[model samples]
Target: MDSTATGMRTHEIFIDGVRQVFHVAGTGPVCVAHSGGPGIAWEYLRVPSLEQRLTMVYLEPVGTGNSGRLDDPRDYRLDAYARFLHGVVEHLGAEKVFLLGHSHGGFVAQRYALDHPDRVAGLILFATSPVTGEEFWNSAMAEVARFPERHPGRPEAAGMPDAFQEALAAGTDEDYTTALRRILPLYFADYWAHEELAPMRAGLLAWIDPMRGEEPAPFDVRDALASIAIPTLAITGAHDFICGPRWSRMLHEGIPGSRLIVLPGSGHMCHLEEPEAFTLAVADFTRASVPGAR
Candidate 1:
C-alpha cells in the first residue's frame, strides 16, 4: 500500500459544509488525477506505475467519494466542478501542476484547463471526449452493437443497451458497480485475461456514502480546445465504446500540437488493459511538457 510514500496525507476542505477531500501519494513531480464516472471514487484511476515516477494527487470530485453532496443537480455542471478543483489546487499551494482526466473526469479536466490554463503545466485526457450529447452516446452504442462481429459468442453485449441506464437508476453504489460489471466485458479486449487482477483492484477502490447529485450536465468544449495551449495528450482504446478514437482525434487535432495514442484490442479501460504502456505514455508526456520535470 506504500503507506510510507512521501506526502501520503489526505487533505480536506469544506464546500457548503460538504467536505471535498484529496489524497496525496508517492513522490517526485506532482500530477493530479481525476477519475471517470463523475461519481466514481478517485482510487479507481490509481496507476501504480505512474505513482512510481510521479507523486499522484487523487482528487475526489464534488458529490463523490469523501466529497460533500449538493442538493441541486445543476451544481454538477462542469463550471462548478472546475471551481471546486481550482480551490483544491490552490489549497495544495502548487504554482502549476500536470492534470490527468479519465472518462467523465476528462469533462471536468477540460473545464478546469479552459478556466485556468495557466495553472496547468500539461494535460492528459484518457478515454474521454469533447462533448457528451445524443451524438456521443449514439456513437458508443454503435460500437457496442459491433462487438459481436469482433467478439463472436459474446452475446451478453446485446443487453448493454440498458446496462448503463439501469446502473444509473439502480441508486445504491453496490448495485451500480454490479450493473457496471455486466458491461465490463465490453470494456476490455480480453476480459478474462486481466479479470483476476482487475477485480482485485476494483475491490481496493474507496467509495463514500451514497452520492447525492443531479444528472451531469452535457459538455461541449470543442471551440474552447483552441485556447488550451499547454502540452496535451489524448489516449483512448480503439474499441472504447463510450469515448472512442473519434473524440480522441478531436482533442488531438483541436489542441495545437497535442498528441493522441490509440491502444489496439482494448476498450474503455485501457489503463488496466495495458497499464505499463499507459504509464510510460504519461511519464513521457509529463517529462516533455512540464519544464524541469524531465
Candidate 2:
C-alpha cells in the first residue's frame, strides 16, 4: 500500500477474482463505503472531513476506477455486490464497520446490512431510492429536461435516455466515454462546472469500459429495509431531481431509527455540491451511532 498527499493509505485488494482498489485513512472505527452509479468510482465522493474522523474505506466497485473487470457481466448484480462488500470488510478483519453509500451505492449498502446486519455498526444512505419504480424514472427524466436550456451544446437533454440506450447498444470505448462525460453534469451541475478535479473525470470515463456489457441490477429493498435494525442516516438534497427528497423520505420512514437530513440547494451529488453541510450531517450522525466517535 502507498500513501497519498492527503494522508490516506491506498491499497489494491481482490475478491472473487475481481481486483478492487480502496483508500483507507484516519483513525477510529471503520466506515466501509462506496460511490453511486452501480459503477461509479470513489473519486467523486471523496470527503476530507469524513476521513478525518473515521477510517474511511473508499471502495472502487469491480469494473470501476482502478478495479479490474469481471469476466462475467452476470456478476454485477446487487446481491453479488453486497457479498463483495462483505468480503472486503472481512478481508480487513473489521468485525463491525459503519456503512455509507451515495445514490445507487446506498441501495447496495442497505442490501448488505439486511443480509448481514451483524457486520454493520451504522448505515448512511445519501440520495437513494427504495425501489426503482416508474415514478422514480419519470421524476429523473423531468430533472434532466430542465438542464438543456442552461447547459451549452446540450440542447437535446430530454433525449438523453434514448441516446444513452443507443450508445450502449453499439458504442466504442470513446463513444461510451463521451456519453458518460455528457451525462455526468446532469448529476451535479455545480461540481462538474467548478471543481478542478480533471483527473477524477478522466478516471471515471476510463472506468466505463468494464461497466459495459452489464445491466444494472434491479433495485428492490422493501423486504431488506425491514431487516435492518442498525442506526441509520438518510440524506437528500432538496434540489436533487434524480432521487429527490421523496426517495430519501421513503427510506427514512421505512428504516427503523434512521434519521433524515435534507440539504438546501444541493442536488444529486450533495456531498460535492455542499461538502460542509454533507460532512457535518454525516459526522453528527456518526458520532451519535459510534461510542466516543465525537
Candidate 3:
C-alpha cells in the first residue's frame, strides 16, 4: 500500500458477518487508534505526529465512520465493541499493537486490554475513566457551572448533559449541529477563548450512539486493571469537565506501573486545544516504553 504524507488507504473486514472499515496510514509497527464518541467518526482521534512514526490503523468503530452499522442495537454495548476490537487486530494479522483510546473509545480499549492483555504492547488512554455513569453527568453539571454566567449558551447549557442524547434522538444534522453548539461551553476550561468554532467542527463530524455507557447501569474496571501487564500512559486535562485529572489519577493508580500526564488549563478537547503537548506525550510514552531509552 503506497502512502504519501497525506495519503491513506481504507480497508474493510468482516466480523460476525458484518463488514467493518478501518483506515491505514504510514508504515512500521501498528498503533490502532479508537476514536471517542463510541459512535463518533475516527477523525477526532487523528494524531498526525504518531501517523508516520508508527502506522496507525484508524478504527471507524462498529457503528460509526465508514464502518457498517449494527442491526441489533444491543451489539453496541461496550463488551461487544471490545470483542469487535479484538477481531480487528486479528483481521490485520498483527500479534500486538500500541492502542490509543479517547473518551468512550477509552472504555472499549480498557475492556479489550483487560480481556486480552497479551495482545496490547502498551496503552495510551486520553480523557477516559474506569467508571462511567450518572456520576459522569453529575460531575459535568458542576464543571459547566465554572463557565461565565454571561456565556452565550449558559441558560441552555443546563441541558448539556442530555444534549448529546437529544441530538442522537433527533438524528438531524441541524439538530445535532445546534446541540453541538449549545453544549460547546461545557467542554472547555475557557470556552469564550476558543469559542464555538472548535466544538462545532467536532459536532459536524460526530455521529449518534444507540447505547450510552450509562446503560446496563454504571460499572467500574478498577479491580480488573491490576492484572493488566502492559505499560500504560493516561493523559487528561486539569479542567476536563467529565474526566478531570482526578479520574486520570484513578486510572493511573489502578493500573499497576502506569503513568499519568495532565495538561493544565485545558478540558475535554485538549487533544485539539493542546495538540502539540498531547501528541508529544504519546510520542514520549511510546519511545520510553521501549526496552531501552536514555
Best by TM-score: 1
lDDT: worst 10-residue window of model 2: 206-215
Best by lDDT: 1
Off by over 4 Å in 2: 149-170, 189-203, 206-217
Task: Report how far residue 8 has shifted in candidate 3, in Å.
Answer: 1.4
Which residue pairs overlap in candidate 1's backbone? none
> Lowest summed-lDDT stretch of 10 residues in model 3?
145-154
- C-alpha lDDT score of every prediction, in listed order: 0.78, 0.76, 0.77
- For model 3, residues 1-294, the per-residue Cα lDDT tens digits are 344656788788888887788889876668898887656668766777777577888888887766778898776788878877888898888888889888888998898898888899889888989887677667766665545453555565456556645654656545655666566666676666765456546555555676644457676788898898899999988888887888889999998899999999678877777878887888788877766643
- Better candidate number, 2 or 3, judged by lDDT: 3
Q: Please give the RMSD to the true structure for each candidate, in Å.
A: 3.1, 3.1, 3.2
lDDT of 3: 0.77
Model 1 CA deviation exceeding 4 Å by range: 1-7, 154-159, 198-217
Q: Relative to the unseen true structure, what is the C-alpha lDDT of residue 219 in candidate 2, on a scale of 0 to 100?
A: 69
TM-score-based ranking: 1, 3, 2
